[model samples]
Target: MNHPLTDVTRTLGGIAYGGDYNPEQWPREVWREDVRLMREAGVNLVTVGVFSWSRIQPRPGTYDWSLLDEVLDLLHAHGIAVDLATATAAPPPWFTRQHPDARPVTASGTRLAHGSRQVFCPSSPAYAEAADALVTALAARYGDHPALVVWHVHNEWGNHNALCYCDTSADAFRSWLRERYKNLDALNDVWGTDFWSQRYGDWEEIDPPRDTTAFRNPGQELDYHRFCSDALLTRHRAETTILRRIAPRVPITTNVMGTLEKKVDGYAFAAECDLVSVDHYLPAADPDGHIDLALNADLARGMARGRPWLLMEHSTSAVNWQPVNVAKQPGEMRRNSLAHLARGADGLMFFQWRQSRVGAEKWHSAMLPHAGTEGRVWKEAKALGAELAALREVTGSRVHGDVAMLFDWHTWWALELQARPSDQTRYLDAVRDWYEALWTLNITCDLVPPDADLTGYRAVVAPSLYLLSDHDADNLSRYVDQGGHLAVGCFSGVVDEYDRVHLGGNPGALREVLGLVADEYLPLRTQDHALLEDGTRVRQWVERVETRGCTPVLRFADTTDGGPAHGGPAVTRHSFGRGTAWYTATRLPVTALREVLRTLCAQAGAHPVVDAPPGLEAVRRTGEEHAYLFLINHTLDTAHVSVTGVGVAGAEITDGRVVVPPGDVVVVREDLTIAPA
Candidate 1:
């Protein structure tokens, strides 16, 4: 792989062992001891200068790279790779005092007073100028250094961000509207904004929708979120452009917080970077790791569209940020790390290789704790290190996929922007519903963005769509009509991006075409589940509708004598256009999802990637010479994995069964000489 990051990757080889390194927060002599301990733990990469902006340039027109210079220089001499940072996490106190507009405003109407990093307003010229200047200075000074492998733009950009509605942002918002609408006429249609006598006569009348600032138009508020995203992107580009000028080939990236709900457009931002990266932190007590870990990894993996990325920050144990902090049990850390890797991550990394002596993260997990490497954390980290050191040769091993779930930003934005009938209707949950279903079927599915073409994929699942452009709808219709298998979930195709429901029926444009009739309905009450006339309870809340002409495999069973069934037409199938469409009226249980997905799987004729037991996960990745199957037993009990795709030489599981222990991993490889079981 002749990647622009090849040289950096050479140094970033095997496993990226080191994590956050803030020598500025420690004594100089401690740096030596830290390095000694890091070497003992096989630590190689040091992410330094994350929050050193205040120290780097204490004032405008001043530079103090001496400390960072020493840090980077020492790491270079020691053969440790350095992910040199922009040191722009925080604007110095003097810069903020001099240019108060440099601060950001929250969605709530308030001017932010900066006391923390990540408070700088992306819309402010002062902040942009300062950030750009700092990046330029750092890259220019150390671009060619052997130790500098990656450019970390800034520390977590969307972590409890500050409010900043200075004059600059307001002016920029108007300008943004000018470019988007060209005139107010086109904007009014998308927003239907004049219904409340809220028509804008000029661009100057436009402003960000702050919570305290009067009116609340869905279109305006949503666009404001989009505007904020674009503004931040503009600022991010400013710094990346500087890095491009200096280290044109060095991979540039930033660690995005897992499952970030901020207004920032990470999907677009990923396109600008050479490599995508994210921090991972999921609580041990989470009923399921999907919300905090699995789904986050899937989203990040999807952000890059199957491209390999770095797990920028994750706790080796519990994180202080979660409501309840719980450490990873005996082998839980490795299991969790492998979980992300199975989702297409090429590298695994964590936050704070060394423990922070103070701050909110002081109690968080670390490899070498304040108690030192002799402890349990260090032992676990060392084991992880050994796995990577031994498996270095498979650095670029890829996860092969022919199945993908269509994920979209437009859909995410549109769906979230809509005020749905139920409060539980959400973009992430909708996605999770589909994912949890597929994962249960022992099927490993890739998350794909709508911008990607559907080629060679057996099936594409799009659920709770709630939004789609006319062009996109046509594109989808064509895919299915052309002998392709597609599965869609509830509440889809109901509205356009403007939050206005398409006329005719619940699923609007896709209704008749998908062979389904979703008429306006009788919603079920809370604590009650939908029931099919067959007497089976539909998974979650649902709507009752009339299904005529379509094959109603199951009908809602109304318990109250005179009432229309409180649930949906349990399962309905119909022929639309040139393909077959099946719709489930209500959400399904995990078991039901798997059963339905299995049927869909057989319909699509796709095969499971592994023989994983319940509570375990399995995925296979194939390359030119071999296919690697990762069997991760997420359960505490040992599980059996059946053999698949094998022959004489290197067929370890050919005898039919392989026992994988609790929280253990099995990396079985084949020469492609085996059958596709």
Candidate 2:
């Protein structure tokens, strides 16, 4: 499980505890003050040179390294390691002026001008060539620098220009399709071009799926998304190849905006990185934002295959992008940082070190806010850094859990197409609901892909998986047959990978495994409600299900017309092979869903780290010789959790008996014990 970038010697202080440092924006004298303040705050690392393309390469073929050398040398003198960026995220004005064709074109056919970051088309040959040259030069210059530990290749790909429909992109897309389909006939059949007279007789006849009169071809759109992802990956690989060639010992990575970003596949992108890194931001106004943050962290760890990942960027307080920017309350920042560490993040960094004085993000919170070092934000940042340094034993740990929730980018894309069963059906919302229910029960779960290995999990939950490939369907079936418990939501297994409905029945390929057939989909309006067998009211959707060998776990109330759906199965359980599958026919209320999940976890013999009270979060991370338990209290009142089975002889428990105050964390370290069966 050891990655090239995770070695203790390669990292700073065994844990990175700084943020993005842009000393280039400040005066030379300010750089000395910045380094001094960084050391005082216990910062061991900083990401430098991001968004400096214009400064580094003011004009094409004219390079300046004076400022960069000064900054790197200053950081090295202060014992601060650098996560060096390639400075290719935003092209300089000169490059764009020289290559006008590099501008990205939107789906509306309007070519975007070059005033913003990521304005260059991903498939533009001129842009790619320019970027490659810059990256090569950077690697050749600083690949062996003493301050460099990690190479950050371009910031957040596909953030702004994920897709481009210009002629250059169209040609690249056509070439991509040619490689995939090999012939026009194969492409026609897969795309279902026979419908709507959209069949293409020649590869040259196709173009990017621009804004259309009606709905665009779903298959074509899906393929276009795939092409866009590949195009960006191509750019990433080019830079990574050059970096690896020059800095053979250094690790290269790019920050991924996890689940929040829908354009790129995280698993595929993680494959290109030496280590998985993610930028996670939470809505400051949402009361349930912590649950979403935990879910995203779990997904990042899963992307790293259960190994520790890097928390590349988060805010010290309120982010400026939201409609209402609310700063974090006292103790909230430390709680957020520990939550990520509890979920298997090896390093914790923020979006920035010092607050920017200008630009769109001038209002964004940073470690050192506009109020200076005397501010509460800076005080909290220093405290958190010291705490993280004290808990160095928790670095490079793994999180163990027996429950998993399935997440797939392709399914997310197809489920939310323009035409769908219900407008209330949001992919992330539904998944978050189930994940939050489990969170309340103190049951930890991994966010896994549909095709991930299921043998290690005692139970799996698939929420609103509308699209399924035959391979994934078979994999789930095999998992159920081999003594795995599964809970599938309504509207699942309804379509193939191409967004085409399965012909046989709803939940077509999974009928045998589920032991039920859905005859019709009943999408209720926003305010509509239906009664479950337990007298629990549900809403938004219901399935008219007929059981073959499945036993009804819940039934719907009688309909107004007394149709066949009246008193039909609302939830069913089938005993398949040595395991079982539970199907939820509608979206149940929170209380009802929690009860159902509790029952399922009991049946699967899944146990939480400790029996925690409400509003208290419990998670465990296991290192080579010890298991660290984190108990965080999100409520205003103090919360106490039992530590009977959580600790071993001679164990150290911080703050005594896992008692956590409001918005505080308690860490308990014990000898590693075997997980309960």
Candidate 3:
């Protein structure tokens, strides 16, 4: 089956560069000025009418399109395209007043108010009907408008109102379970309800794993997560159906929050979008925030199945929500934008165009700050816009990585459940450690689902994946058996899809393929550290391992403490049918892990794009005719690089060596045409 492609260049003719334009926020007189500034800044695209539900439909059944029509006309006249929004993200006050049940109810049974955004229940009929009507009206009115290029669906689905544990949701859950399990006996068996005499005789006994005295059943909680993710996706599909029926030519997309979003399955949600788009922000306090940015950009590209994605929303400076919204220093924003572009983002945008003066996000940074055109942010935004325009040839290019990291939403949810081995075992931290090592080595990585095709990748890494389905386990085993390299981290393959223990041994389904059997879990205390025979430090967790058909590469150092794991295998290697499988029973420090990965990558035939200096980020995006090498110098001191390519104008490239100044980006395009030797 062929999916509709999201081609932004078809309409914009270049890389999409702009932010969210909210004309309704300002007086009508200021609208003209917004367009003039946008033209001067080289903004070719802007998202319009995202949160304009109340303004568009003042009363229950009335709609006023005068404001929207005028806004679109002005943008089109100024040569700017629109990513018109459906305006159903936030319901108006009148909607909540008429249908109070539409308000999302908390797990504690408190129905939230409508003062904030995304306040509607996912399963409420009233909310669905209202949203559907609004989407239909917008699609019908502006389906053929010249200014419109893409139909922006609801803003950030599952960000705030991901789950609603109301009676309506309970009924929906029961129905969803019925379609999934088909009978009470099947549901009971999968949920392992025979434990603690909690077997259910009927569907009525089942409910969401809502507030409980003790730890709720892990199986029940896992299924409930699946239900919630599907519920929100159902809403997105509803709006998509209306849009495709009315305006099938215009591609539809809703901005997705990157790794920060845990409530919804991002991979499943992305499958519904014509174009995969993500909204990412830097951690204000983290000095190495650029590393996280690269991680998410690669994840977004993976979500798009290696296609170029859009950077829908990021801050030009500080955000308002954090405890301390630290601002981006000079040249930081430019470096951040190009880093994303280098990683495979075709369109770059921000949270907003103009800063707000009277809202919850008044302090949030924007392209046009509160200080207006005189601010540093505005000047940088213009320069970045022009740079994006010059790099339009990169729009359809794709980022290629020899390494793939297995990331699963269900595994993340189940791994963090109560009554686990260690509260210190965080899914994000474990995954980041592996990605950071790859990033430091300048080796590109793609965060892929467990079921993704592994033949194309040279090496695959699965870290802290506590839950594993039988099908996915078979997939990984098959990949390894077919001469592919694989590395399984600690606590992986412990449970089935229902969160039930695999019963025979630890890492149940993968034991045979991995050639190892884990006996007992040894979760370390907060301050405890274990030493490896190779003088490497292991922290957080370890396990008692008994090698089945493998060789121990690294063993625990001998100790006088008389611990059960005094000299056990800390890491092992197994040759499984023409390929190798590596397993780690303990968490290696990031620096040590980097060396381990370096060896594994070398053995697996995976190499970095370039040998970059420390603190300098390097990545490559390849197309049919050219390959772009992006060298971003995050360090303070100027550095020189050796690469043969044509540099963008103004870049300091001479002969084989290129000079990169401190805190800047340089894109070197390598022509694919080979000269006769």
Q: List the candidates ranked by TM-score, beginning with the highest.
A: 3, 2, 1
lDDT of 2 at 264: 86
Residues 1-677 of candidate 3: C-alpha lDDT, one tens digit per residue = 23233366646777889999888899999999999999999999999999999999999889999999999999999999999999999899999999998898887889899898998989999999999999999899999998998888899988998888988899999999999999999999988888888899989888888887888888888888889999999999999999999999899888888788988999988899998889999987788889999999999989999988888899999999988999999999999999999998888989899999888988999999999999999999999988887888877778999999998899999998888999899898888888898999999989999999999999999876799989999999999999999988988899998888888998798898889999999998887788888777787888899999989988888783313476999888899988889998888888988887898899999998897798889999998889899999999988789988889745757878888899989999888786636
Pairs with steric clashes in candidate 2: none
Encode model 1's per-residue lDDT on 284-371: one tens digit a residue. Answer: 5666873347667777877766666778888888788767887778778877877777666666777787888888689888888877
TM-score of 1: 0.93
Over 4 Å off in model 3, which ranges? 1-6, 561-564, 675-677
Residue-level lDDT for 323 in candidate 2: 95
Q: What is the Cα root-mean-square deviation between model 1 and the actual structure?
A: 2.9
- Which candidate comes out best when scored by lDDT? 3
TM per model? 0.93, 0.96, 0.98
> For residue 648, what is the lDDT in candidate 2?
30
